[model samples]
Target: MTLADILASLFPAGHAVRVTDGLVSGDGPLGASRLAVVGIADRTALGVDGACTLSRHVLDVVQSGDRTPILVVVDSDSQRMSRRDELLGLNEYLAHLAKTLLLADAAGHPTLGLIYGHSAAGAFIATALATRVLAGLPGADPSVMDLPSVARVTKLPLETLQAMARDTPVFAPGLDNMVAAGAVHAVLDPDSPLGPQVEALIGQMGADDIRDRLGLERGGRPVAHTIAARVAQDAGGG
Candidate 1:
């Protein structure tokens, strides 16, 4: 079965989930059960418009006293590469998703993100904002262009680029780099005990109460705490 299929199985009766055109999308079944799954199709192909529309709709549901758990399956290597997307304000679309996730959290929906593929730029940001982030054994990687893209962007030779990636955490792919960067929270082999983990997360869901097990708290991601730190510093407390 595909990863999407496995995720769909995580939901039970009254859960809304389906795979259509390669996008795994769903919503709450009843009056608001903490359960929904959104899958990213070709992370690089997902643009701001689509992300904005989908994420906005999700937020609308959350505002209605329905504390549904939103499961995000992120696997994109980059945002849309078209100039049209930028002209149309891709940043705004991505920001909309961010706000929606924050709203979901504030409304008591436990937002869980699962990374089974590439993640980069907007894709990375969207998932990182989730309350919990889970990574597949091979899911963690550069989440962006390989050394070749970096070479082009940096004007460095491919050989030199690869060597640098090996030494620099920024360019490296795989689980270690993502983990060190605080992108992935927990690493699990496909064969590992996912059921129990899911249950544990479900039991821990709360209204605006986040558990710092994976991405936000313990995952060594600088950006995670950077916001809070800035706020605290601004408040003259830090």
Candidate 2:
């Protein structure tokens, strides 16, 4: 599904929206909150401008102190790579964006990210990963980096990396793989009515990162549970 489809699913008919430089800002479901949805459909990148825009909206929400829920709809395929972006300190901008989202969360605002398309690398971390809860549309692809990119960095043969991905979901780049590894909270079905599901989740919101536990329960990342338990036991002087 596209970002437009996701937006339509969340907002009612005739809901007013403001779109500027690829960032879409509007009132959320039933006028309960504000949403800043970021993405460029044809050209898949989140640049410094987009980052700043989202950061500003997040700061606005924090300042409002109404605990307005933040809805993130990410569809970027990559972070913008350019000499100008680097000269402008793109990393700092992304960090600012992340910090703003965290501040909103600290202010008691529930932040949720829905991946509607391809998301990877630094852009994914800056937007989707910053959320309190992250989910993906069934066809969404989420990754730290693509397998070919990883192979180039690690100096591994492409065939070997492809083989490894089949058995390991940790760094695999698909929604189902992320859900299995606890990277994505869930993969949403497009046919389902998203409004009621979102409202239900909003009602149950809490300040807990429970994906690791979920991974263990789903038999997808048992090592996370084991390591956490071991760390806790050692900390207790056991």
Which candidate leads in lDDT?
2
Q: When superposed on Cα atoms, how far off is each prediction in RMSD?
A: 4.5, 2.3
Q: List the residue pairs that clash in candidate 2.
A: none
Q: After superposition, how far is residue 60 of candidate 1 from its true place, in Å?
A: 3.2
Single out the weakest 10-residue window by summed lDDT for candidate 2. 34-43
Can you write out model 2's per-residue Cα lDDT over 99-200, one digit (the tens) per residue? Answer: 887887788888878887788888888888888888778777788899999999999998999999898887577888788888778777688767666666
The TM-score measured for candidate 1 stands at: 0.73
Please list the residue runs of candidate 1 whose C-alpha ends up more than 4 Å from where it truly belongs after superposition: 12-15, 27-34, 42-44, 128-134, 137-146, 202-234
lDDT computed for candidate 2: 0.76
Cα shift from native, residue 132, model 2 (Å):
0.7
Worst 10 contiguous positions by lDDT, candidate 1: 206-215
Instruction: For residues 115-136, write the lDDT of model 1, one tens digit per residue.
Output: 7666666666755444444444
